[model samples]
Target: MLPASASQLLNPTDVGREFLRLLPIALFVIVFGIAFGLASVQAGLTDWQAILMSVTVFAGASQFATLELWGQHVSLLPLVAVVFAINARHILMGAALYPMLRELPAGRRYGILFLLTDANWAVASQDYQNGRQNLSVILGGGLVLWLAWVAGTVFGVTFGGLVANPEQYGLDMVLGCFLLSMVLGGKRSPRVLLIWTVAGLSAVAAYWWLPPHTHVIVGALAGGVLGYCWKERRHGG
Candidate 1:
């Protein structure tokens, strides 16, 4: 009683390929998540609470941003808005699938979106556009990232602070470096670069001018809109 796509998610080749391809990034994400967990502890979160958030939310920057705002005594409404806004990128990422998955049933398309993340989106988007990817591949790879992030957070929360001179590992910059490298690679077009620059600047500005978390929402919306608009203009759609 499973759909074709759901059955595809269990394909061994897809899972194996993703497992091999993600090995390097897996370790990196783990270390990065650990750093976040450690940060959560120092920010006054209990050990179990930090790990739980990582497992349940599985969003690092958003989690950190929310915690930072909370530490400053920001109201819960704004905090929720900010995190939701930050997560809006997933919508844009899922939109990238329209061209590739237009023929799939609605439920399957939504299922894919539910598992998408910035990292998996980057990898799977490329594969999808290239006409070589399937639901199996995306799901296989996404599960890896999900597990890596969760394990990493738990590892860091449990033992990171105890490590003497954790700075020596330089794990703090993992996510930034990952995004920077990805953006630099994919920002090949002038329009893409313009949107990226605008979004980055807008987020920073929002941080300073708007209410708490507004910047995150604003940046995501601006970037997504710019990308969509640019694509429309270029494609005459």
Candidate 2:
């Protein structure tokens, strides 16, 4: 919970300041977006299609995963499930920000959420923990990141054909490496570790035994259920 004195104001000045602060990080995001654009092309999407996906979805990890099954004769149910499982973390993220969001009008609240990404969320979460409120990052920082992603996609789409063999250059492994980095970089409390362990094992089992593409659903549900049932203990009263 935020401190009672924490401000919920969402003024233009603060929004502009946060936008500039996040610009540096958005540069890195552009690189990742470039990678995704190349991969999307290789997976059979046109330049405009890839760009539109990035614009509408705005979820990098899920977009990359979608590329994995793009050319295959995959079921829509499983495809949708996989995307949902990958992006489900947004639900919890939104819940965490509900306190600050509640103070805003519905239009502003949902508008800010439309631009929410991991980087901006981290900025806001860290500030909240330090007894500060920073919703500006959610709106302004998010806009910059979105633009960076779109810009990177444009570059990749234009030059992606140069890299004829993404596999030869190990570009094929980028998604796996990126997801692993996220896991390793995140908080590793015991509860989180346990949930991840269960999720990992479930995914492996589903891969070996269940129908193709079901591992993601199995793993996500396993982890989500465990996290819900085994609540974390609060440290102080």
Candidate 3:
């Protein structure tokens, strides 16, 4: 039998409420997006190209990584590798949502994955942990965040020089800080702490020894594997 949390239907009203709840955070995302726009232009991407990239590929970290690789003679292999490695965390995030997602039809299930991002996923996961079914946040919150990102890119393209260096104002750390806040808000057990520790050390090791841009995925996978094992052991599965 499915879990009670998994049986809850997607609520449109809840989705709208989630959208409003996430608006404040989306404001910060806009600022971060502006930084990306400026960096994209500095990397020689045309304004349209930058805007389009932001629209299609809403993954900020990977987009920034690509800026370093952008040039007249861009190599395909390294570009693909870095983007895939950095964005691979979505794989785990999507997997984590499967319990809830499976309740929906296959089309709606996969469709929601397109809107998956760190912020919305964090909200949804936290709700699930508390035995709440709140998939609406994934849809509504993701929409707002995606729109904010695109809007920010447009602003940056138009006024790329306004914030010449976003880092000076610490805009670069916005997303990181936000994610950290979300993590701290969640339940923190001994097992969770150990899993995070393993993930962090694995990330550091990968950053030093593995290829560039691989640390993020390596850390995520390490944490995920540990978490999965703990779950299995707890259930005696």
Candidate with top lDDT is 3
Candidate 3 residues lying further than 4 Å off, grouped into runs, are 1-8, 231-237
* Tens digit of per-residue lDDT, candidate 1, span 46-92: 88888888777877678878777646465988778778877766666
lDDT of each: 0.70, 0.80, 0.86
How far is 204's C-alpha from truth in model 3 (Å)? Answer: 1.6
Candidate 2: worst-modelled 10 consecutive residues by lDDT: 1-10
Better of 1 and 2 by lDDT: 2
Local accuracy of candidate 3 as per-residue lDDT tens digits, 1-237: 455443355667877899998999899888878888998998999999999999999998899998999988999998998889889889888888888888887877888778899999998988887777778899889999999999999999888677677778887777788788877777788888899899999999999999887787889889988987787446576
Would you estimate the TM-scores of all the predictions?
Answer: 0.72, 0.70, 0.90
Candidate 2 backbone collisions, by pair: none
Predicted structure 3: lDDT: 0.86
Better of 1 and 3 by lDDT: 3
Clashing pairs in 1: none
Worst 10 residues of 1 by lDDT: 1-10
